[model samples]
Target: MPRLRYIEESEKTPQARAMIESAHKTGAPDPRVVSIMTRSEIGSAWVELWNKVLYEGVLPHKLKEMCRIQISVAHQCGYCSTVRSNVAKAEGLTEAMIEDLFRYETSPHFTPREKAALRYANLFKQGEQAIDKDEVYRDLAKHFTDEEIIELGQLCAQTDGVGKFVKSLNVISWEEACEINPKLTEARAEAAE
Candidate 1:
């Protein structure tokens, strides 16, 4: 059960309702989070910004999806981890690729560009103080322009920060993720080790 109450259709503002409907149709963010967020105008705006960053921008949708899922898995937010972007799937992102996310460095499915983005997402998840900013940016520069890097960083920050909040909402916990896919826990554990 969600710790936050999902605003029902009747009570939702028109903007909120529209966002919830669109979120359901898109499938990138399950309607559950949108439903809860649309309760406030600020949250609704946040959802809008999320959509823009996720669905628009210079970065490939599939690449963003890859980074999103990787960060979600690292954070162990079951809700975020389980949600899939239909657009990304249609664009050729596959379960096979996702399965190799924890081992992206050695995965044959990703390109050098994709791997760089994944590496950026991984280090960003580790917290600001933990990263070697100059070295990370230098690596990213080889595969991405400054603008693309900014978008990638924004996506990682958004997922890492909000995913933690969502995990706390009881939408999906690490324990639940372990139940759903034991491999997810195992992969994270192996990564930690």
Candidate 2:
């Protein structure tokens, strides 16, 4: 069971319901990663925009997954790291490769591009240190685009966005995130009253 509640199907407004339904629902389409934001379609705007950059963006799944997992770990967020692991698996990354994310520098599973991306993620998450290394940009640019870089930047930023709710709600595991997260039903209950 989750520490929070799952949104009920009926409780969702038609638009919000459709948005969630149409998303990539393999295990859980989009958990918003420990979000307590409204379950209304209003929030779907941000979701859709994200999908546009992620699912529809120029970056391939492998590259995107690499960045996602790397940033999630840099933030020390177990939830995001696990979610990225699953996504990477679906996209063809192996368990070894996923596990290697914590020590990717020495892992042979990563491609040059992937290693470069991971290095970029570490630097990106490291903040001010990024400015100290002008050399980092050359490495990052070989594997990413200005547009793709922007997408990676947003994904990195998500750690903090999701982290706030994750820590506040004490969300530590993906195994029971759905059962614990605030569900559509909960939002409806709140709106109706």
Please tell me which predicted candidate would have the highest lDDT against the true structure: 1
Q: Model 1 segments beyond 4 Å from truth? A: none
* Candidate no. 1 TM-score: 0.94
Model 2, 1-193: lDDT tens per residue? 2366546655666666555555436322245431323253545566666555455567676666666655554454445545543444678876466556656677788878778777776666667567347587666688778787777667656544554445444456432433443332232232223
Q: How far is candidate 1 from the true structure (C-alpha RMSD, Å)?
A: 1.3
Worst 10 residues of 2 by lDDT: 184-193
| Best model per TM-score | 1
Q: Report RMSD (Å) for each prediction in the order shown.
A: 1.3, 9.7
lDDT tens digits, residue span 20-115, model 1: 889988897889999888887887888999999899999999999999998898877888988899999999999888889888899899999999
